[model samples]
Target: MNKNIKHILIILALFASAYNASAKDYLITDFGAKADAKTDNTAAIQKAIDECSAKGGGKVVVPGGEFASRMISLKSNINLHLEAGAKISAIANGAKYTSLVMGNEVQNVSVTGSGTLFGNGGKFTIGEEAPNRPYIIFFKNCKNVLVEDVHLLQSASWTLRLFGSEHVIVRGVSIYSHANLNNDGIDIDGKDIIITGCHIDSGDDAICLKSEDSTKRVTENITITNCIAASNCNLIKMGTGSIGGFKNISISNCSLRRATESPFHKWADKPDHYIGIPISGISGIALEIVDGGVLDQVSITNITMTGVQTPIFMRLGSRKNPTGSFKNVIISNITATSHSRMSSMIAGVPGFNIENVTLRDILINSQGGGTREDAERKVPENEKDYPENRIFGWTIPASGLYVRHASNINIDNFQVRLAAPDARPALYLDDVKQLKATNVKVDGEYIIDKAVYKANAVNTSVNQ
Candidate 1:
């Protein structure tokens, strides 16, 4: 056995021990659920779950075999346990299966085992003839939920999504996707969540958080740590659909890399298209507050990345919604090797400026071959358009970092090293107020004239 599988088994053992000691376990095969990979066992599994629920919150155990099902609904106080070697492959018809497994308004629910879930993502397409596929696992308005020690593979859409849930803990879950479009690894639209000790490789954003409810219920108190992620899109992202806002979030001890083994890599190349739609290179972290969301008191630290297009990308705009506030962000101890097509940027709308942002102990090694014309390019006030890095033209005005329409920014022990010669400055500051940079280095030395550029910046100081 390999080390990673062993670690997953250890976590599975702990989870199984906790739930097995309390629930009255009922094996699915014993309830007449066929193990044939071609048979639809949805009714059998539903009967088994019903029986277990009637017996006062027990476990519906799926033994080692291949079971095919369309959609499985989980009830409160029930534990759906899949043993080692067990596989649940989705078999849906018409457009798409509603979902693989779902939990709605439930409590004390768990899904844990050293098993696998196959979503058959490649079978779906994005053309007009294809229907919008469903997610692998979804939880809505659920409480006291847990999902651990599972191999989630080839999801049709967003793999695992938690919406309006609270007090959720997900650990030791591995996700490998890259079959279809918009295959985000995990989407957390909940509060009081913890996602740790996981590995994710996908075609889109790996770990993303959002708040899209109409009740004005914000997504808050989210912590994601000790995970490794690779994606063709953003590794970590929040808010392109921010109706409720996000607050009190922290991400640490994570590594983000590019997915070189994606079957759809050609579709993600620069100026490439995804089966007809255009695509962009991946960003290590992408943060945006475009649709009337409040983003504040967020901290990201201890992130190491490689083969990324942009190390960090942030934007705050008003698009079809009221203007929102974006402030109080701190990013520290981030080291990255990034592509130089575009610089890491932090920008806000014309009248709405990002405020109170800080960066500490940051280093980026970029493949910079930017020309003077690229530096002199006009930056448009793309306030109402979609908020993303590549959408701000092919290349930004700066080679290293760009800060526009922001205030009260500070950078400490920041360094940028270029791989190729370029005429553009390393850092560009525009329409910034009360900016301070200390111990900032370019290449191996600190040269302000050759590195930093300022326009319409007030009260800015680089430490001498």
Candidate 2:
């Protein structure tokens, strides 16, 4: 009955009232969706979403059942919640999945659950004899979105794709897609996005942040953290698209493991088709501001890799559209153990170059053998139709780091040892400027290979 105690109690009561007013729930099973022991309850689930959206945005609950459906489009202010043991399996037929889930400028939408969304991709067909078509779970132009605690398994193509979205959070999601071809886990083409606490084992790049398509805007302010990625083409990749550039991105606290057996040949017609494509291993952490865009302020830190082919690989060039230059990139605290060659390169057009790049605290353990002959092979003449070939060469020299046509580069605390003494140099620099290397130890010696290092004509420093 004290005055101060009464005042505190009154404040607590007000806060509880506010919280109750804002919270809402919508259950799917209540809306004529029977979780019968045997039934394809796809239509019933869709009905629940329609009713929930009509009722002005609440949770669409999918209880424990095998709900088979094609696509379920999400609405504004709606949260699709899947209860434990609940599974929404995609129909195998492409016609069944013909309806795409459209999210055009919808705000405050979320799909969160501790359940599974299975893309029965094995049933779809792609090429003439291709077993199944590539089906994707795609989101486009949605803002303030959150997708978490879901498992996407056996997706045909890219498992999860976000395009032109903002303020999106994808966390605690596990995607398993080894059976399907080109099963990239998450393809992000959005801004202000955070992807964390996920595990992706895919056929292609586990996580790819693409900025192709010159017409679309650049993707910026993206962060990927606390993830485990394995059995993919590249653990984390960027810029293999035809449009859109990326900036202000950070990838940290992740472990990437390359599968020893080749996964690329699964989708290839002939065994020799993708032989030298650099398909296996953590090929590289690429930052290519190429094809017609500017890439700036990107960093990759605290990454550990094992059984990878190439520890570090980078390319910068202006081949297609003249908008070039990769600026302000830092890669630190990377450790790799592998048998293949370790290589990194930065090359670009005449005017634009890779600039202000730093590599620190990198350790690599490679087999004494040279670069794999297959890895050194050039792009096949048949695949010249691709734009990537026109932009950059097929074969990259086998070395610890190769720099060409770059400026303001720093290398510090780098230690690399080859399986044998016949291995290539630890560092190779050509036609670069303002380059400095400190505390770089290789094979128990400091490498000063003048053949690769060059001082620019104007400045006294190397390629200044």
Candidate 3:
């Protein structure tokens, strides 16, 4: 085993031991909760949780039945445990929204069970706008949290969001929440977190990490492994909200693909010819630093992506703040198959160049049909535009990868294949400095132009 994996397993094992100390169990049925699917069990379940917390920390058990509720809040040192065949469905109170489960300023809390949480998400929306909809689970400013072995489906919005928290673990969770817009699988903003062995299919970004403007806490020391993520948007993304920044993040052994459901929002393009078909995800893995944050020390490896718009995209934009930095990123052992006009990209602003990036052992097969006019197109520097795969107008000049305004980039054993013949370069570099390429095989041409300096190329082949 790798040393990093071994150390991470040891740390996870030690963390798991802390949950076994609480042994008391409090059943919700004893607190006037009904098993009927129509009864409002919000107060009953809350009372049971309150009693359990009042008598110190314990497990508030929900047995095998369907309970309908409005909001369920979890307190400190409490575990919300559900048995097999247990189900909690959120009631549809139109125009009024409350999270189905929320924990605020709590510690040593967990929600674990082989059960299901269903939000009647379709009833809360009106004409593509969900004015008021409930979140499935939202935790804020919490510590030592664990959410495991639960089935989350049809969430109103953002299935599980953790903000300004630490020491979190989410494992064996299956989320299918395509019933509404902005229904992200998991939005995490914390430190020392691990997300493993989960399957997510969502309408928006799956397994996203962000540091919003509401807190000063940076999202750091996070690990995501052995997960399958499918979405209409990005599969794994860090940013779109980069207030405090991200650091020391690692992702490995993951699969990315298109969403299973058609989208509810117009952001996902479903053309007239492909009306009912599921569109590929926008970007397989995207990293953006747009809101004045430092993004450093990110490592991604052993990833497989299928049917994505762009396999990888890294951007440092000046949307909200122009003082952000993006550096020290390493990606390796990646295989991807994409079908889009837009290409993988590494972009930075004019004055702030992305620094010290490495890509090794990458193989990509794209459906390329670019024309010569596309290759001769002048790309613009959209410094303040919204950071997205197609933000700079679609049909990128390069068919394989496009790099601009970056420095100290190293590429080794990088290969590209095309399904259709393209009259464009396979790799295009603009204003890039200190670029080193080794054993790169391109299907078309490789061009370095416009302010590129000191680039070293060895064993680079075209149409090989």
Clashes per candidate (backbone, < 3 Å): 0, 19, 0
Better of 1 and 2 by lDDT: 1
Query: What residue runs in model 1 are displaced by over 4 Å at the alpha carbon?
Result: 1-23, 127-130, 265-281, 444-449
Model 3 lDDT-worst window of ten: 450-459
Q: What is the TM-score of candidate 2?
A: 0.81
**Which candidate gets the maximum TM-score versus the true structure?**
1
Candidate order by lDDT, highest to lowest?
Answer: 3, 1, 2
- For each candidate in turn, give its C-alpha RMSD to the true structure in angstroms: 4.8, 7.0, 3.8
The lDDT for every candidate, in the order shown, is: 0.82, 0.65, 0.83
Stretches of model 2 off by over 4 angstroms after superposition: 1-25, 32-40, 96-102, 126-136, 212-214, 259-263, 266-279, 282-284, 371-398, 444-464
Residue 147 of model 3: what lDDT? 90
Q: Which regions of candidate 3 deviate over 4 angstroms?
A: 1-24, 126-129, 265-278, 443-464
TM-score of every candidate relative to the true structure? 0.91, 0.81, 0.91
Estimate candidate 3's RMSD in Å: 3.8
Q: What lDDT score is found at residue 385 in candidate 1?
A: 90
Instruction: Choose 2 or 3, whichever is better by lDDT.
Output: 3
